[model samples]
Target: MRSFSRLNSMQTKLTLTFLLILLPLVSVSIFANYYSQSIMNEQISDRTKGALLTTLEYIDQLTQNMDQQTLLIASNPNIVDIWKGIENPLSPDHLYGIHTVQQQLTALTNVNGAVKDAFIIHGESGNGVSTLKGGIKWPDVKKDYWFQQTIKGSGGLVVYVPTRESRNPSLYMSEDMIYYMRLLDVLSSTREPNVMVLAVDKRSFQKIIQNLQTSINMNITLLYNDGFVLETNPNSENLHKEEPFSITVKKGEWSMRLEQPREEVFKLSHILQQFTYLITAISIMLAIWIAWLVYSSISKPLQQLSGAFKQFSSGNLAFEVVHQRKDEFGFVMNGFNRMAAAQRKMIEDDYEKELRLAKAEFSLLQSQINPHFLYNTLDSIYSVASSNRIPEISEMVINLARFFRVSLGKGRDSFTLAETVQHLMYYMRVQQIRKDHFTEEIELDEATKELQILKLLLQPIVENSIIHGLEQSPNEGYLCIRSRIVEDRLYVEVEDTGVGIPEDRLQEIIMEMDKITSKSYMSSPDKPTSLYYGLKNVKSRVKLYYGGDADLLIDSQEGKGTKVTLILPMGKEGHT
Candidate 1:
């Protein structure tokens, strides 16, 4: 009661209120000056550094552009091919090669105005082609510093200043010039070691720093590796006392900095300090009023959430969700409170079990076999066919590439029958090319082509027909694939005129296909021993997804032929 009386007393209350207002105001005055100055300095630092980085990025991009331009010319198969013709330079093919190179360089210059000229300096012969007024050949440049630097760069790029005394200096003719040099692209593991130069004006970089300095009241400087100043924009102010903030430009030996005037930097902080005094009395009155509002709006929720935060920080999931509906504070409170409420309600073991189940399901999906071996085999064939220049072989290779691209499910898991037919068409073209051992035919109704199916659905079935069936036959084989919609059901059939399965063996396939309906899942421990690697695999999946609506029918005679029929429900089309 005595403590309560003391708090209620007017003298005590006024005294407490007076200290609360005066002490903070005094501290705020000093703190505001320091804090404002710190913030100002920090903002200037970030802006200056950001501007520096932007300039550096532009320069780096320009260098990369120049490098790309050089590669385009140096790797010009025409230029490399003409090396034989270019040995004499006066030969008809050499002149043609030179003319071709000139056209390429001229096009490059027309596209990018930043580049002055693109040239290739031959390593051994020392003669080369340049874009300066068409093409010009030069004498051996074994002693040139830029050429020496190119060799030192070791196929990478090097940026250097072109001097008046440097070789072919008159070609650039300008005082402000930068030379980006690199060795030629090593073709077929053989280092040609030719020098490629891209001459650009140094002003391209200076203009960047100049553009930046217009907005900022600071002096900027770009320096080379040996402390030589490359570019600078100086602001007229006392910068002697202000140490410049420095940043290193990546990819090259370069550095840049911004020097801010001490006076301009602290200008706002001084104004904020002076205004602080005028608002002291106003702030004191505001403090008394805000104290009452804070207790109701801020204090209670903060206390509740603070405890909850402490519980969370301590790794204990024992806290109630705050349920306030007043303001943004209430939104924050509710989020925490709901989490605390959920922590108590959720079943821990069940949640972990759910996660494990999801992961196992995903792992099962990821483990499914992909036809990469076929891709590698096709890639090898494509490479050989491409080099051999065999038109039929190349066509087969390209078709096989298209087939795999569609079957691999780049991302899509389902595609229309049109795409499926296109894939099959490529597969048949490839098999027909390898050897005309089989006459392949495909028939698909225009209306039924829009129906969708799983990727690589018919590949294994068709592959088996080609390999196991026709490859064994002494006579030319015949294979037919037909797709159509009938009686509101999608029917696909593969018929082959090759050695067919016996009745006993056909029954085994039927039994294997039957087990798919009972298992529901695709993979089984019995899968290895069973002959389900291809046909049964497909049948199981179709049965699993379509249930009783899907059917796989197999019929054969030991000497005549084999026919496999696949029936899927009509509504399964365009599932994705």
Candidate 2:
């Protein structure tokens, strides 16, 4: 009884090991079968459609050529003159003229291989010339169906595809001939207008379908006006079944139909499916045998690894697997141990860095208190100056306090366009008090006033413009701050008519700004200061807040002026 219980335990383990290997093999086989069939279906459908399109284009070209030929013959001066002069069909004097017209018609049929025969018929007397039967007299030609149809067409070209019984006996053309007819009214005579007809051979269209069939091994049917079957390869009526794979493409009045048997199209995929089943069966049998042989060796190590993985997933990054034998499993276990140790170290290092960053940010917040204190002191001084009735001191102190208050942003990092512009005004007012040489103008779009932007974003740019651009000029300078929104981006331009930057210095500053705003510079510990530190600081902050889409562009000319444009993206919340 104890031996039977042990045997049952062995059976359960073997079954589990076998199933673990078999399930994935079966799943892969199933996926491969489905994917291969899908690919084959798509490829076959695309190839068939492409072939049908090619055939349609060829047939359209042939029909167009036929129409052009009919137009060319109907308007021929020689044929028009001779046909009009022929008053008597059997008269000796008019026989030569009729012969000339017949010769011209014969030449047309001989030149173009697609034209089987050409004819010129008189509308009233039913007497005209034919390429096949010259100087023929058909007294009832006016009563003929094609002639009456052409006359009713009112000079427009008409095409006719004749059945077997309706083939023209006078021209001796076959049933496969299509007729293109038009009234010869190029030169108006007193008599009824003559009719010009050309019999086009359908073999040209048949040849195109045949060529396509030879390459793709499919049946093709050419239809005229989606109704009449002009030609079909293999000459079989029932070869193209509606239930099978088929495609139809129409061009103008002509269309092409392509068909292939479903079984024939998917023959290769069926073979692949069969082969896959065979492979899957053999793999399952082999997997069961392999599982039996290696179960004892792999069972314990897999359990150890699985347990270690569970612990590691449950926040135990220090978990490791121990194995003595140096096989594939041992290699995996050793890799897991090293990976765990590396992961634990990475987490520790990241935590330490985050803690340091938090402390630094706290230190920065603590440092801002002094600026607030200064702002308060300036406000108090402004009040004192107001009480003493010193307007100049009062204005200066108020502007200074407002500038520092806006710079601090009340512990917020963003403000509306109005507040931002108001902050810059405070700074500029303080500067104007010191030096009144520069004239300032601020033009902002009313629609852009509510757009939230980074605090103090424009202050440093304006400062650079006034100090470096306006101050260096000899005459009175102009400083203009304009704001507009274009294509969902806010554009702010600070234009100064002062001594501009030299080309060399501007290029140097541009290259330095590029370096400062780069990812590598942001990650580095050392960041050197530059003469254009304000501009660099603006570029860096724009890059940090708005990503790479925001831009700071400086266009300058020595002694002319400088324009610094800031393009900021208006994100979903109206701030970036």
Best by TM-score: 2
Q: Model 1: which residue pairs collide?
A: 321-337, 322-337
Please, what are the lDDT tens digits per residue for candidate 2 over residues 442-477?
899998888888777787788888998898888898
Quantify how close model 1 is to the true structure by its C-alpha RMSD in Å: 28.6
Report the poorest 10 consecutive residues by lDDT, candidate 1. Answer: 521-530
Please give the range of 10 consecutive residues that has the lowest summed lDDT in model 2.
Answer: 361-370
Which tens-of-lDDT digit does each residue in 354-450 have in candidate 1? 5565445434433464555587788888889889888897798889887877767777767787787778888888888887899987788777787
User: What TM-score would you give candidate 2 relative to the actual structure?
Assistant: 0.42
Q: Estimate each model's TM-score.
A: 0.37, 0.42
Indicate the residue-level lDDT of 479 in model 1.
91
User: Could you tell me which residue pairs clash in candidate 2?
Assistant: none
